[model samples]
Target: MTESVMPTYGRLDVAFTRGEGVWLYDEQGEAYLDALSGIAVCNLGHCHPAVSRAIAEQAQILMHTSNVYQVPLQSLLATKLTELSGMSQAFFCNSGAEANETAIKIARKYGHSKGIDKPVIIVMDGSFHGRTMATLTATGNPKVHAGFEPLVPGFVRVPYNDIDALRMAVSHWPEAVAVMLEPVQGEGGVKVPAAEYLDEVRTLCTQRKLLMMLDEVQTGIGRTGEWFAFQHAENSLPDVLMLAKGLGNGMPIGACLISGAAVDLLEPGNHGSTFGGNPLACRAALAVINTIETNSLLAHVTLMNQQIVAAFEHALSGAEGVQFRSKGFMFGIELPIACTELVKQALAKKVLINVTADKVVRLLPPLIMSADEANKMVNIVSELVLAFLATQPKASVA
Candidate 1:
C-alpha cells in the first residue's frame, strides 16, 4: 500500500464528499449533521454561497498578485476587520500560525525598542496557537514541543486564570515584555477563565508595562456571539490580536491586528508575505464578514447556543459528570470517561462531534444553525451519550 500524505493526523475512517450548511454528505450521499465545522473554520457553514461565490468570481477575475502591488480587496477586508475589532492596523497571512508568528515578531521588536534584550512573553498552560516553530513553542502543551528540541525561547509558561502566579513569574524575568492568552481557550477543552480574568490581565500588563496579546484565532469571527470575542468585552483591548480559522469562513486567511503602542513596531521591510493578502482570499473574507452582518448571525448563534445548552442539560440531567460549558456555538461537555469513541458513535447516528482534552466533547457547530437544526443535534447527541453511558461499568470511569 502507498500513503502519499504524511501521517500527521489521527484521521477518522469516514470521508465527507460535500457539505452544505450544518450537514455533510458522503460519497454515497448519506447525510451527517456537522457539529465540528471543520474545527471552527466554517462559521458560515460548508460551501457557503457568499464565500463560494466570491471565491469563484475572484478566481476568474484575479487570484494572485505580488504583495508589491496594491490589492483593493485586501485593503477593504483590513478596514472591515480594524473597524469591527477597534484595531488600528492589520498584517494578513494565510493561516493562524503565520498570524501568531507575526504577533511574536512584533512583540520581539517592541521589546528591543524598549531596550529589553531577551523579550520574554508569558503564555498560559493548555494553550494551542499553531504548529509552526514559534507558535508551537508559544503553545503551552508540552506534547507540541516533543521531537522539536531546542524549542523557540523567550516564551514563559504560567497557570491559566492565575493572575498572582503570572505576576510572580513576570517579576522573576526582567525580559518580560508581553502577556498572550486566549479570550476562551478553544483547544483547551473550550475552557473559559474567570469572568474578570482578562480585565485583571490588562491591569497587570498596564502596571508592568507589558504588551497584552490575545490569541482569538478560534474564538474570533463571531464564534463568541460578537464581531470579535473581545469586542465590548470588559474594555480590555489587546495591543496584538491574532485571528484565523473562521475569518475566511473556509479559505486560508489569517490576520495579525495591532493597536495602541504596538502599532508602529513593524515597518516596510520588517515583515512581508508572498501569498498573503491576495485578492481571492480577501474577497472571500470580505464576503464572510458581509454575510455574517447581513444575516444577523451573531444573534442567531446566541439564541441557538442557549437552546442547545438548555436542551443538553435537560436531556442529560443527573447523568454523572455529564455537565456542559458553552459560549455561543463553542461548547464542551465533560464526560465521566474518555469518550474518544464518541466520534465514530456519533457518525453512526448521523451526527458529527469531537473529543478534546481526553474527556471533553467539543462542539463548534455552524453559527447560522437554525432552531430546528439545533434541536435535532441535541436529540441525536443525547441519545448517543445515554447509550454509551449504559455500556460503561457501574463506577465512574475516572
Candidate 2:
C-alpha cells in the first residue's frame, strides 16, 4: 500500500475506521477525541445526518452535469451563501486553494478592467492561501516557497494587521489593486488580530478603491461562533470572500463570494471549474449551511468557545509563557518552548491535536462537541502540556 500511495503526507500510524460527532474509532475500536476536525473540514462532525442525507439524496438524483447546464442545487447553494455573506455573486470551486486562486484571478481581472495591465495584489505575511502555484507564491512562509521557485508574481507582501504598513504599500506600489488577508490567521498559529483590524482594512480598501479579499477557508462556516468570523464586526465586508473547509461539512466545495465593486469582475469563459458546483457538492454545502442555521450551532459554538476558553485558562493559569488566544472554537496555546513532538505524544493519549507555527498548539475541534467532550479535550491537552513541560530540563546558556 505504501508503494502505491503518494509520499506527500507524513500520515499517522493509527487508521480511523469511523467517526461520529467529535470522536473517531480506530480499527481496533480505540476512541480518539478529534480536536482537529480533519484540519477544520469536518465542521459539523463526521457524518452529520443532514449532510449525509443530502449527499445520499443527491447521489440518487444527480451528481455532475458540468457547468455547461443548469445545476439547481448549485444555484441554490450560491444563493444561500451569498445571502449569508452579503455578497452579490458566487463562483464555486473544490478547495480553499482553488477558491483563493479564483479570487486572485478575479482581482487581477478587476485591475485589468481598469486598464492596469499588470495588477498587484497586496498579500499579508504569515498568510496560508493554498498550495497551488499562485497561492503558494502569495503565501508568506519562505519554507513553502523553497522548492517552488519562479513563482507567480503580481503580489506584494505586507505585515498583517498593520494598517500603516498596508496604506504605505498601497501608496508606494502604483500597481496595487487589492488587499488580501485572513480574518483570523488560522494556519499562522491561529493569530487573532486586534478588534479594529478588519474595520481598518475595510476602510482602507474602500478609500483606496482596492478589492478587499478575505480568505476565510479555516475561519468560516460557524467555526468562529458565527456564520463567519467577519460577522463579529459590523463594518467587516470583503469584496472577494473565499471559503472552503467547513462549507461542505466534509464534502469538497469551495466558493468565491463577491460583493461591492468586484462583484462583476469575472466574465464568461474567463474562469471556471468542471466539477465545481456539481449537484452533489452543492447539496452537501446546502445541507451544511442549513443544518448550522436550523440547529442554532452558531450560538452553541459561541457558548462552547467560552466554556473551552475558561477551562484552558483555568488549566494554564499562572504558568509562565503559557497562554491562549481564541475566537469561537479556534484556539492556539503558545508555549515557552518548541513542542512539535506534542502531536505524536497527544495522539498516543487518543486525543488528536496539531502544532502550528512551531510552538502554538492549534485546536479546531468539531462544532458539535458537547461541553463534556470539550472539557475532556481541555483536560487531556492541559495534562499533556504540563507533563511535557515538566519533563523538559532547563536550558543553560554561556
Candidate 3:
C-alpha cells in the first residue's frame, strides 16, 4: 500500500478490476471508457474470446519449451507473420526491447559481413525505441539516458522526418549500416512523418546499401489500419521490421523480421530466446491474427479512424487553442498548455486517456472500438479540455 512495494508510476487513485471490449471497471463498479487500450497492447480488446481460449487451451497443453527443441507453434506463427509482413525470416523475443536488441545485432552483423569493422546506425530525435541498455542508447530522448551514462556507441542521432539530416549523418559516419525508426513515434507524442518520407527513406537505404529497419512495436498489426504502417505507402517496405505490443493482444511476444539480403545475417546460433516463441505466445498471436482477419477488423479500424478523426476535428477545430494530429487509431490532441492534470480530471469522469510529451493527449484505442464508443471518448475529453482552457489566465491563452 506504499512506495516500498513498487516503483512510482504517478498512478491514478482508481484501480481497474476488469475490462471488456472498450470499457474497464473499477473495484467499486465505476465504468471507464478505455481509450488508451493498455497503450495499444489490446488491439482486439481486453480478453478477446478467441485469444483467451487459445491461451487457456495452450496453457493446458504446453506452455513452454526451450529453444533447443522444435516449436511448431513458433514456426506456424512465423509463417503467418511472414505472409502478413512480406519478410523473409523472423527472430522471436519477449518484449519490444528484446526485438530491438535483435535488430541492433542484425545491423552490426550485416555491416561486419559487408566488411565494415565498426558499424553505426542512425536513430531519430524524439523517437522511443525501448528501455534496455542498447535500445536506450538508440532512443533519442535524453531523459531516458540521463543516469544511464556511457551509453552504447555506434549510434548517430538525427532529426526526425529530415532526409537531409539523415543523408548528412550517413555521410559523416561512414561506418553507418542502417537507419532505425518508428513508423509512427507513439511514445514521443504520436508524431507521423510526411507520407513521402518513408518512400524517400526506402530509396536512400537501397541506394546506400543500408538496412532500413522500422520499429513497428506501436504501429504494426491493425493499429495503423494496415498490416504494417509502411504498407500504407506504395512500395516503401523496410528491410528489417520489429514488432510487438498488440501482436498477441495481451500476451508477451516480440519479433524481428528480416527480408532481402538482411535475412541471412542472423544464423541459427547467433541469437535466441527461452520463452520468446513458446507455444502459449505463438498460439495467442495466431488467434489474434485470425480474429483480425475473420472479423474484418482492419477495415473496421480504417473506418473508425476516419470517423474519430473527423469527429475530433469538428469538435476541437475552433475550440480556442486545440489541435489534433492522427493516422488511423494513433492520435494526439495537442492543447495550448500542458494538461497533465487533465488525466486526473478525465479519470474522475470515468474515461481512460494518457498525456504524453507534456502537452499532447495521446490516444491508441482498440481497433474494434465502435463509433458510439469513439464518440463517448471524444465528448468526455473534449469537455475536459474546453473546461480546463477556460480556467487559464488570458495572457496564458496565447
Query: How do all the candidates rank in terms of lDDT, highest first?
Result: 2, 3, 1
Residue 301 miss distance in model 2 (angstroms): 0.9
Give model 1's TM-score versus the native structure: 0.97
**For residues 166-252, could you state the per-residue lDDT of candidate 2 as single tens digits?**
999999988888998999998888999989999999998999899999999999999999888998987988998999999998899
Off by over 4 Å in 2: 396-398
Which order, best to worst by TM-score? 2, 3, 1
How does model 2 fare in lDDT? 0.91
TM-score of each: 0.97, 0.98, 0.98
* Preferred candidate (lDDT higher): 1 or 2: 2
Instruction: Give lDDT tens digits, candidate 3, residues 1-398.
Output: 47686863666788788888888999988888889989989999888999999999999999998899989999999999999989988889999999999999999999999899999999999999999999999999999999989999899999999999998888888898999999889988899999889999999899999999999999999899998999998878899999999998989999999999688788788998888989999999999999999999989988888888888888787677777889889999888889899888998898889999888999888998988889999988888888888899967878
What's model 2's lDDT at 300?
97
Against the unseen true structure, what C-alpha lDDT does each candidate score?
0.89, 0.91, 0.91
